[model samples]
Target: MVFISLLGLFLLSLTQAAAGSQLFDQSEVFALLGDDVTLPCRVPSIRSCSSVNWNMVEEFQSITEVVKAGAVTAPGGKALRLDLLKDCSLAITHLELHDARLYSCDIGTLNSSVSLQILEVTESSNPGVDTIELHCFLNTYRGYAPCNNKGIRIKWRSGDSKPINGDRFKVVNPSECFSKLIITKKLTDHHRKWKCQVTQDDTVKATTSYTTTIKGGIEEVFAAVGESVSLSCWATSSLGGKGGGKWAVGERTLTHDMSPHNGPFHVSEDSSLVISKVSALHAGDYTCSDSTDQQRGVNKVRLHTLDVTSEREPEGDNVTLACVLTCTKECGKDITLTWSGDSRNSWQSRSMKVNNLLTNSLFLPVLSMASDEYTCFVHRDSDVMASKKWHTANPLQTPAWVVLPLVLLICITGFYLYNKRKHPKDAEHEQSSVVMTPLYEVIQDVNNEDLQHQRQHKRGTTTTTDDFYDLLQAVN
Candidate 1:
């Protein structure tokens, strides 16, 4: 009887080894964190076994059954996460780091096993800068332990299939299990998604993606009151072109497919948000997000109205020019008021801020009546945000209406004087011609009378020489 029992035990050990060998290189499986994963079991006896069981091999070779008799038996919702499929494989949903372990499926005396490793991706960025770094690595044991990376490779790509390797995007391989993707922000970087892939022996094993969110890095958009403005998405001309996107302002939300008109806002065909007539109410944070509800970009729009007025200083003949800039409380801080053009001493102006309103004043002494175009600049740090031009004619300066008549009178007087001097010689010649004509006529008459007298003398009528001489004197 003892000999028979030994032989039976030997046969049982042989059968268990045969069943485990049926797994056929089912050694490891990779799954992305927070995703659903399945460990396959294809033993030939799976369908004919009297009972199917799924177990997790814990540390120190301890065995914990998760599924028994083709049903989940783990505690609480953990049991719900673990399910036995029709083929006796084990399925896990909403996978957690703690789920990474050696998983096994047992069919009576037959068994198969696989090791689970989690692929996780994370991102980091500096404040006030548009650069970000993404890290992808294999992890296990609740992210405290590194998984073996023999023959494993990691890579990064943009969107779905665009490989990322250029000046703006750089990939660094610190290890076989670790990868880093550095991105310098651009317009196209907004609303973009990057994917990390884990491959072993040239076969893709796991993938995960990270989406960039615009937080402290805001794109400032400035517009004047009553002017139309378009708030485009950070990257694309059309918002949500990849999947779908939406525009948000405070508590209000709008989708890409919405009607063209929503109050003062209009959604164009290209999916840009247009403000028909920008007003104080439109100044605030505008956010664009993808269909997955991930924030892609932010627009901090500043809407303001600028006006300038002048008055005589109470103490002197100097004029006080005050520039007023008005906006809503939603306008962010860091605004400075500066004046350009006109007097160099205008740099000595004074500025004050009350809530969202700012005033800059310059004092110009009464010297000469002059017209100057003074511009008020709204400054944020070294960058100029907006500017408004005000044409100031010193109250001491001649009015435009008064100057017009003076200019016309001066022009007429100049023309009259020029014409009078241009024809002096012609006027003298005309006067001389009028005065000398009668003298010439008298001389001609005398010559005619003399000729008549000469003819008479030649006809033999004796006319004395004294008579002829007296006639000549009378004619002269």
Candidate 2:
């Protein structure tokens, strides 16, 4: 039993050795026009192989006939030769567009023949630009067969001719069946009919091409001081694709922020910079660009500051103060209008319709009859352009009471002075006359006369008594 087992093991080893000797393995193939391409072929088996040969087979042709043989040519018109003992690989130099074909490595003995596909090779061209160096690339991740090797070669050709000799073009392999082409110092002459070709073992050649052209820069659409202006930039061709654009004043990027603005500053969807009030500060070169893709459409815009004349109603007037915003283009919703000074003092605002270049007015009612300094400020939102303060004349009317008090006091004082100056002597004379006409003997009486009259009357009334009274009176 042991002897039988030993014999069976020996036979199994022999069979494994035979299978290994006839085995072959290879890597993917890639090449450029007028460049050398190596076709990888390896023997992993332990058996001693008799010979190894490489064959080229065109896709459009049959591979049945055998032809010339030499160090440079094989029996079937193959473009490469291989040494069996030392090297089982094939080197094809000066490749061409038509050289894109399948190649196979065949190992043979006196009785057996085994073949392995070595890979196809092809040529490619690089893309060019006028004043820039553009690197051209071709990616081939989606190809037949799983390519474990990721290396390729690149070359450059002009107008269906052989490739030029230089290191201006390079090919690199980043992954299995993936490669890229890089070209240095691309010229305008090299922009025509550039192609990229990809090749791998057991797969067909793939080629892609691109055309080159010049790109343009950005331009200013509209720019004015103290006006709501729209700045626009567009690519020369509509086919250039869509990109993001921005408006800038000096180094600051202008955007739409609806917060309360002391001055005018705002923006719109079309990148219209609406400076609510245009001032000298707003007088700078404004730039607009599509920063996302620098594809030479409207890349940059220049804004020029212009002199804007602003006007408004004078102060203390029951007039409407209008802030006019001027612009070359139609004003959009980006513009904000506001009035400063007295109009703002009242905090009363009116929504003014945006006309071509003019705005509506802020009405001031019951204006005071005094010189009023009114200023109308115009802006987009934050950008103030011009502020105009004007003076209005008002009539002066004096009050009656202001002079009445002084006139009354003057009349009273004048009367008192006249009486003193003219009646002083007369007042003294009246006093003297009153003193002379006064009181001294206006009261003396005639008592004796009255007594004699009474005595006579009594004697007549009665004889005796009267005679007695009479005698007595006579004696007295």
Candidate 3:
């Protein structure tokens, strides 16, 4: 039925053109809402004539003269938005929804018609429900005939050009002219950036972006110590001139120079503050301002670092895994640390003040069979703000001091046993040799004394044979 009506309109238009003596041409122009566009008068007979006139169909089928005699004749405030062109064309700037209309350009012996349509985005958010609703649609003049949208579609996409589809995203297309996107908000979606695109035959005809504000209060940006961090400034407006502005920590303004001599803090091209190898000293309140407008306090962000360290207990057989969280601002009571691992064993974290740092320590058994992966989670109530995963030992690997002594003891015992087993025969042989040495020495002495006696007897003195017999009895 809709197609029959459209065909009827096309036939009626042809009939009207045939009845009119002037040559008639018709075209449809698509434009983005809030942008500028020109409606061309393609009639070849058109000349640089002051008699060229542009008129639009108003509500109640009234004709309103927008441009007359090469001049903008639009009423009141609309006159500022309309312009006349040399080729009898009509130019509109800063277009609004009401500007979409069926326009007629009349020149000498020729008439050109243009139907203007605009694509726009509108949003409504419910803070209580934590949801945002976006509507992308085609806008035309009220009471005017519906503009042609045969091959046009409105779609929602993420910043990375991926179509948004998940449990948190609900999409509804109520009509061919518009689409609605509903998003459930999450803490991780603080940026809340989305894009709406109008495509015709798979080609993008118009596009717009919607980003929620992170302003109105001080927010936190988490970073680990010794890691690079970038704190983004709220880009309220397009930046111009030297830079977005200055970034300051506490009262000291950060340097913007990109040279190597510049300190760790540098201002990025997008006006974010980039810190290289951020440390505890970098934890503080940071503020970004606009340079061109002299607007101060454009954004305020609190920098916090979650640092993890492990130490062996001095007096116990346990390892202390400490999560030290440093906040440039006051730490909320909801902030907490949770230790998680693959093992079923659960360790409780104890909060303590050590060396002017707030540390949460988890004491695990020295011989824990937990897996190599352990995570330290920084949580605010039920939400995980940040987490750090580290590799730890299972059976908590024995220290070198404990292992070295055991190895040394085993080596020494092996050496002693080997020597004792290998030389048993040699020890027995040595004992028998010691027993024979005394007997052999006594015999030698006895023989020597007898020889001396013999010599004396031969010289006319009798030698004592009983002394030799005494020596032999002693040897036995």
Candidate 4:
């Protein structure tokens, strides 16, 4: 009886295990044109007795057994045999655009389905010039739906090398069903074999290539620091594929082998180098090359160094050392004054209005004999382009006593002249009157009066007018 009970218990365990080893949901399907894609199928549980099968359902009432596990009904019936049910996934090789459709997977009594969609991508009809604009479109395919309502990856190649993104090239999405790749700047490298690759779900499925001749050489390149830059390495002729471009620092190579994407350095399509922060270490000679392409071209860029120092002075007895700027245009509007010294110290600034010829002065008041350095920076207001340390002049100190003597003399002279003019009538009156009389005339008149008085006394106190007149005439 114990043996019988143990066998029954083992049978019950097997049944429970079988029930747990079943697939719960459908698998995901992916398809791409001109490329192979995988159809994923996963079983939630694993059981020894469970079986899985993959079949292709096509046409009405027609089911073909493509893969089978656990059981087989007919031999040599074009059915794929699966020795292990765990690896029951389907792989479609070299899938065409028409291969996009629903697929089925069945396990024991459970069944699930998946759908896939394919998109076609073609090469650009016009590969575009470095300076000219280019537009790329999708290619046409048979037995496939319109290449609409799906996102496609667009990439390019120049000659045998891979294409990269830069300021000159951009992708534009005009509508839900279409996108355009535009090349803003044209270069001679754009004339080589150009290709467009379409990718769906990280897999490149189709590619189209075109050949176009590019004109002109590289002119100017502008790039930012710390960002990746790509340089176009194309040629003018079809045989110029071997004659591409390269990047260099002085004589050093900065091509793909020396620096990959996100490597120590990078370049743009117009041969612009992107150095992050652009420190002194990044300062060096940079050159773009196309020796391999046989065109043998090079471009150079120089990195500049910048250093700044600021100072502040007290209001009194402070000397300001300012930088004078020579402006080609109006300096007043383009110039700015700033003081950067003590963190807590505030800066004083004044701006002059711009004119046909700009002249700006940064004024600093110095009350005493304190020497303080001041900096004046001039910049173009429109571009914020500043001049180098063009003018470094010391502030001059002026004393108030220098003008004091002249001011006092002017005040004294003005007061004296004002008083003389206000009393003009009194001056005239003083000039007209004589203060001193002749002494002889005064003595003669006194003597005559005395003699007349004596005579009158002598004549008993009576004197006639003729006697007074005679006395006056005798005195005269």
Whole-model lDDT, model 1: 0.63
Candidate No. with top lDDT: 3
Give per-residue CA lDDT, model 1, range 140-236, as digits (tens): 3222234344678888866544466456667777677777788776542443467889899999888888877654445556565556778765533
Say what the RMSD of model 4 is.
Answer: 29.7
lDDT of 4: 0.43
True-vs-predicted CA distance for residue 103, candidate 4, Å = 2.7
Model 2: per-residue lDDT, tens digit, 30-113? Answer: 344455565555544424333544444433333421122213344444434323333545555565554444444444421121
Give stretches of model 3 more than 4 Å off.
1-23, 125-128, 140-148, 214-230, 233-263, 266-272, 276-476
Highest TM-score, which number?
Answer: 3
Q: Which ten residues in a row have the lowest lDDT in candidate 3?
A: 427-436
How good is model 3 by TM-score?
0.48
- Give the residue spans of candidate 4 off by over 4 A: 1-38, 42-50, 55-66, 70-87, 91-101, 108-110, 118-121, 126-476
Q: What shift in Å separates residue 90 of candidate 2 from its native position after superposition? A: 0.8
lDDT of each: 0.63, 0.43, 0.68, 0.43
All candidates: TM-score: 0.42, 0.23, 0.48, 0.31
TM-score of 1: 0.42
